[model samples]
Target: MDMRLLVGRNVKRIRTARGLTQEELAERSGFSQQYLSDLERGRRNPTIVSLWELAQALGATPVDLITPDDHAD
Candidate 1:
């Protein structure tokens, strides 16, 4: 599977599990809602800094965003 899609799915899963909307996550991550939307859709490649910010915002570690899902195997 593609890394972009993997990260995107993880981001979306974590975000939803935390009960955060895209707008709220964007605000917390200091990014735009459109960017978050693109990210969640696997249409954007986030930089390391962006990933760190997003992980912090979501109360997760950066690795959590890039790790493959348990169901991926």
Candidate 2:
């Protein structure tokens, strides 16, 4: 699977599961909502530090951000 899609799905899944909106997450993560939207659509290639920051904002770990989901296949 494409790593971009994998990470994007993880981000979206986790965010929604936690009842977080893109705007809210953007505010929390210091990223724009548009950026998050692009990311969730697999249009963004995040750096390690960006992933770490996003994970921290989402109350998750960087590993969780990068890990493939069971439904990822």
Best by TM-score: 2
What C-alpha lDDT, on a 0 to 100 scale, does residue 9 get in candidate 2?
Answer: 92
- Alpha-carbon error at 58 in model 1, in Å? 0.4
Pick by lDDT: which candidate is best?
2
Give every collision pair in model 1.
Answer: none
lDDT tens per residue, model 2, 1-73: 7778888999999999999999999999999999999999999999999999999999999999889788677
- Alpha carbon deviation, residue 5, candidate 1 (Å): 0.7
lDDT scores for all predictions?
Answer: 0.91, 0.93
For candidate 1, write residues 11-66 as lDDT tens digits: 99999999999999988989999999999888988889989999999999999999
Provide the lDDT at 26 for model 1: 86
